[model samples]
Target: MKRIYTIALLLASLTRVVAQEAEQTVSSKINQVAVFLQGAQITRHASVPLKAGVSILTLTGIAPAVQQQSIQVDGPASVKILSVSFRINYMEEHKKPEKIKLLDAERKRLTTLITQEKSIQEVYLEEENILKTNKSIGGTEKGVEVAELKAAMDYFRQRLLDIKQQLMQSERTIRSYQEELAKVDAQLTELRAIKGQPSGEIVVKVSTKAATTAELDVNYLVNEARWFPSYDIRAKNVKAPVGITYKANVSQQSGEDWENVTLTISSANPSEQGVRPIIKPWIVGYNNALSRRTVSGSMMTVTAGNEVHGKVMDDEGQPIPGVNVVVKGTSVGTVTDVNGNYSVPLTSDAEAVVFSFIGYNAIEKRLDKGSEINVQLAPDVTALNEVVTVGYATSGDDDSDDKSRIYGSSAQKMKREITATEVIRQTNVEFKLDEPFSIKSDGAVRATDMVEYELPAIYEYYCVPKLEEDAFLTAKIMDWDQYNFLEGEASLFFEGKYIGKSILDTRNTADTLVVSLGRDSNVLVKREKKKEYSSRQFVGSNQKVALAYEISIRNKKGLPISIVVEDQIPISNDKEITVDKLEDSHGEYDHNTGTLTWKKEIASGKTELITLKYAVRYPKGNRMLLE
Candidate 1:
């Protein structure tokens, strides 16, 4: 018996060894194959051989979204996969088996209890129906024979109460079973998820056309595992219309699932297009201010074929009349009339022209090709140096050698010499009257009997600057009243042309005369007054009279000047009259015919006052008067 027992033990030990060897062979083959998780392209090779009893695998960088049983070995394996265990944390994998085992036991316990609760509820319903039937029989018998009925009622009541209590208890047990069943279901659902294998490396490709640098951050999760891809793309000496792409290969475990994958690429140059080019004008002048001139007036006209025309004014901006204008060098020039305009011809050879007037500075302008030219002339304070107006003519001492001399008598001088009486006679008188008279002892005279006379006269004279003639003189006296005395009749002549005119008129009683000179000039004036009267004494008695006279001279000049006045008075008395206040006064006086003589040396361009007053008495009845 001992021998047979030993042999049987040997056979049993041999069978156990064969089973262990088969399990090892299956695990080796399974471990040799790569495992891949759902949603991940990378495959993971086993670090350690998987045995036939193994139900879980730990992986790095694996996706969490992998489904249970989704993990598969790509190569042949001996054992089929029955279940998969998944865990977010690697350490949780170690406890997965125990948790799954406890869940299965709880599920079995709940299933058994649920069946027992359902059977007890059925029994409670049957007892409730029996108690109802007993109550109905008792009510039908009324008070007849209740001895055994009480016993039956008591037993039925007890059984009914017990059954109701059991039913209530069953309901509570069923509720607790349902709660346990829910917990088990949740555990089963969690355990069904497949754990992904680790993806050791991955490959990433980036493409761009910008001439700049780029950087990328890629984050991926596989089976609740996370991985980050960090890289930078740099471009050097890159030009436009050029593109490049970066490719990299990274390795990772195969069973990892990709989740929450974020790939971001940032570049240094953000623009997709190139830049373009720009262009600006030239300016000139000081302070951007322009110099301008204007020429204007009535009698003058300014015309420039290709030149600008404008108005001319004085320093105070007042228009000046009769201005002389000329070019700078050449003799191309013209004079401004009363309107202050001059159309000085431009010279083709001249580069610039000068504009000059009597009291203004000469202005020069460069000849521009434009049709307009404007210039401004400043005031010339030294205008007295050229063509200054003297007593009766203009002196050319101040002019340049090439300039023509301005020779003309001033209107003031000629108007002053011609009296109002002469002008009236020239305008109105028909026949000339000539009578000689002499100074008397008392400076009084009587004229012979003559007819009454009334007549008007007119006179005019003109002086102009000599341009061609050397010297000339002319005179004319008209008849009748056709030529009457009026203002602005006396004209001045220098050389031969008229420069200006003077107006002379008599006062209210045809006694006092006033003279108005047009232009500025020196003047010399003369005036005469004469009167005649006659009377016969009774019988042969002699007649005489007294005469009184006053003479005054007013000089109008800045400096001392000279003035001479001569008077011829007719005298009838033989006795010589004595003159008074002669030397001490303005001039010497004559008392022979009551005639007074005044001579004075006045100042230059100034008015001097000369006055003479005297009285004379003649024989009674002898008439004495002035004519």
Candidate 2:
């Protein structure tokens, strides 16, 4: 019985050793990545030598924020994949970035220098104290010769001066080292601000018939990575083709660097919910005791206790100013400054916070236990269209205050190795680059020029003198559908100078795409109230006011230009108030919106004028201002 028990224990111990040997750790290389508008899909490949039995392959260096459900593993058909699982490799820490490492080295060097200099200064201080304690040269009770006293005085004076000079020089050196150390610390702080987690591991259990080299492919979706579209539109004059340069701004902080890997920029986001929304029954009913609808317009005051502060950035890793950060379910809010930083006081009622911008998607984060919450907002593909209005918009002190669009290019341009080969898929478009790209895990935007086009376009000047004095140049392109252009911010350049930025508004279903080329200084426009045609009279029980305006446009350029002018008449909403149009200068009038539009062509050095007259009548006692 004892011999049998010993044999059983030995067998159990051997089985455990075999089980441990079956598990193998493998390192995978990221070969390619498909970055979408909101997320990214990483593809990694590895070659593993499988034994002729059950083997567990643990792949390392996976992104920590990977979606388990999106993970896919492909290998030889002979090897059957038994099971797959993912877990954070808490034991294995991420390697510090090279920049951070260099900065740390610099910091250490400066710190050591400062310490040595301070120690020298301390020694000098001690020596000075000793000198002061024995300052009385020779014994005071004995009278010394004048020559000896002079010699001692000279020695003491020169030595003390030398010590003071040495101490001052040492103090200066230490201050300089401290300044350098502070700079290194600032750089380290900026680099370390992007918090990255430990690498993730994927364990795959497989059964193979024989020992062989298996080429495995693994793909999964990861968060904190995205790409956005932007453009640069240039036109020399009205007769030249509109030059358009399409670009993609890619950014990632997925804790995994894509080193020399093929990139595919896609317009589809795999992170979005795939389920289609269904329409529920539309039941209409009157307001009852339990069915009363309540609307909230007033903001609740924030109680002071805790403060939430963070920075807001776009998907391209650029600071977004004027973003509204508010407490969820309350009106306590604050706007981000020019640096995209905000601080809002919070109370116990504040369970969550929301960050919203005009052209970016809103982000909501729960305040579970932290005070600092930084967020990166993706551009709302649908919200770009909201800036494309029919008439001119007024500029405000803040760019986000009005619907005014912005256009600007990157401060520096980088030359890329290759262009993209566009592939049209059923659900999304993909731009596959020809060469591999090395993108770091740091969240910095890397702009890649995708494609350029010189398309034929008709140039026209647009003006709304009542709203703005500037005449905006616009390019109208027909059959713009062939471009497959997405709505994005565009930089405008005309006559060899960069004018401004505008939205590449493609939300219109029409075949013609109108691109704003920004304001033209050569085309002068002015609107003035014609006092001779304006009058105000008070009749019995009612007041009548007649208003007239004249708009003038001058072509200062040497070439003739066709321009469109638009103005609006007030639309009365009150039943007692009535508005009548007297004259429109043969312009097309839309009664529904009280808008008048005129198309005209002016020769070089010529001016054109258009007149609009309207009248408003309201109750005599109630005052109404008309212009």
Instruction: Report the lDDT tens digits of candidate 2 across residue range 81-149.
Output: 888888887777677777887888899899899989999989988988888888675686998889998
Residue 1, candidate 1: C-alpha displacement in angstroms: 67
The local distance difference test score of model 1 is: 0.34
Best by TM-score: 2
Error of 1 at 9 (Å): 52
Question: Clash number for model 1?
Answer: 100
Lowest-lDDT window of 10 residues in candidate 1? Answer: 235-244
Off by over 4 Å in 2: 1-21, 107-190, 193-196, 288-418
lDDT of each: 0.34, 0.76
Question: Candidate 2, residue 593: CA error in Å?
Answer: 1.1
